[model samples]
Target: MNLLVICKASTQIGFGHLIRSRTFVENAIEGNMNLDITLCIIGDSSLKLLLKNPAITFLFYEDENQILLTKSYDAIIFDTINFNKSVFDKIRFNAKKIISLSPVFNLMPFVDICFNRTQYWAEDIEKLTLKKYGGFEYALIQRNCNRIHSIIYKYGLEKRYFNIAISMGGGDAANKTLEVIKQIKNIIEPFTFWIMLGEGYSHSFDEIVNEIRKVKKHEIILAKTNHSMWNVLSNTSLLITTSGITSYEAAYAGLPTITFYDYDNQWFLLKELVDTKLTINGGKFSDNSINNLRNILTDLYHDRSVLYDMHKRSKKQFDNEAANRIINIIKEEVFKT
Candidate 1:
């Protein structure tokens, strides 16, 4: 089977979509060795570093149009949030079937299969075609999820400081990392902050380092790499992050999280995550958010039960084999005899 996987990643939009698409393709190939895959990412060449499959062909965003105009694929899987009707029409002309992942587009009628792990569109599920699937059972977790289990046990050993991890996605277009760090400085308690920076982070590292120096009462560790965040979250007592792939990963790792929505679409998914009772919603990113997060943090710090309850709920909700399930479903649906 010939498959075309499309997604986007950039410093402005972050890498969630690309990460999901890449993981999906990896899983798909592992499950079916005969499949020929071409991964088209709507971003620059730097984004190629995230994908490691030499067998799959990589195409930049600019070349997508020409590729679509020429060759055809057996199926096209779109993992991007940016859905354009015109582009969808173009893609349809070059593909036999269409499948969408993660955030759903309004143009669902044109899609043959859609998978949204969150309950954002639960109300519309019954009204859709038989191929539509939703809920955490279909969540596409990173491949490194299994590795974190042992790490979590290793880090579960006693520690002195309350470790809080702040990861605001790759781009952090709104620069919420600095704001979150600054507000946490107000807490007089003994806490250590781990700031996970992504490749797309365009903010001045020097500025964040200078801000870290100002905190005398607490310790701050700034992680500036594409390192496995699971390791960091394994040791972390609390997570301060945007409602993205990272939040779900933390949930699967049984780590409590305080989430903020950086984008408009994130707001809907955030609501569903809050419904799971695994995370506390910190609302949208804004000027007033600093004080709000600080207050939430202080409350969780005092009430250990709240965090522990969330931790327990997480283990009950998330499954590491969701990616395998999704891949199996795709093969069953698209490759039916």
Candidate 2:
């Protein structure tokens, strides 16, 4: 089988789409399904770093015209907002199956199957799809990265002291990570801090490293281009991150998390986490909300039972086996089509 995946990644949009698509490819191969894969990404750096398979082909395009040059695949999986009906219609001539992973607004009606894991699908769009699968049914893209699992077990994370991970996605578009570090400077003492900044962070790398140096009594480690997030989350006791798929990853690893909302697009995932009490909004870092954050942090530090209970609840909600279930869905939907 040949699969073509269209996606994008950058500092502003982050790397969730690329990461999730990679997970899909990984599981497809592991299922012993002989396959050829091609990735169409917007950025060269993201394409080069994210796609590791030698058999994989890469293409870079900013518009729909590029779709005309591609050969037909058994299926085409799109995970970007940029792919509209025009682009799909151009390629639909040869492609046997058209699948979308978390579409932007459900504008494309011809899609064969729509896979939305977070229940973030729009009601109007859901009604238009030929077939729609919703909920946390297929979000488990982690099983694709075998190296991450090995790293998790090798890191001795299960036996470590309290471990806290701070991740703001592939790009820290709002530059809120440093502010988050400052807010927790005093409170996170005695905790091992693993900070993963997006490769596209706007601030100079030096500036971030300097700030880490200023923090006292905290072991701050910077992570770059490493796929060890699963291992890091597996051993982590708590997490403070932007509300995105990483929150789901933390949940899958059974880590208690505090989430910060960075953009309006992030609200869907944030709403779900907030409703479940799996995450708390660490108020924005602007002057208007800074005081609110200070108070929330103070209160959070004093309430140990609330923190513990949140962690316990998180473990109950997210399952590690989610990847396997996602794989099963692909087989039943896209491949079977």
lDDT per model vs. reference: 0.76, 0.64
Candidate topping TM-score: 1
- Model 2 is weakest, by summed lDDT over 10 consecutive residues, at 144-153
| Candidate 1, poorest ten consecutive residues by summed lDDT | 149-158
TM-score of candidate 2 to 2 decimals: 0.79
The digit string of per-residue lDDT tens for model 2 on 29-142 reads 666456667777765454466566675567777544555644777777788756556766677767777777754634457677777667665555756836776665566547
Error of 2 at 57 (Å): 4.7
Q: Tell me the alpha-carbon RMSD of every candidate.
A: 2.8, 4.4
**Residue-wise lDDT of candidate 1 within 32-63, one digit each (tens)?**
77778888888778887777778668778753
Clashes of 2: 2
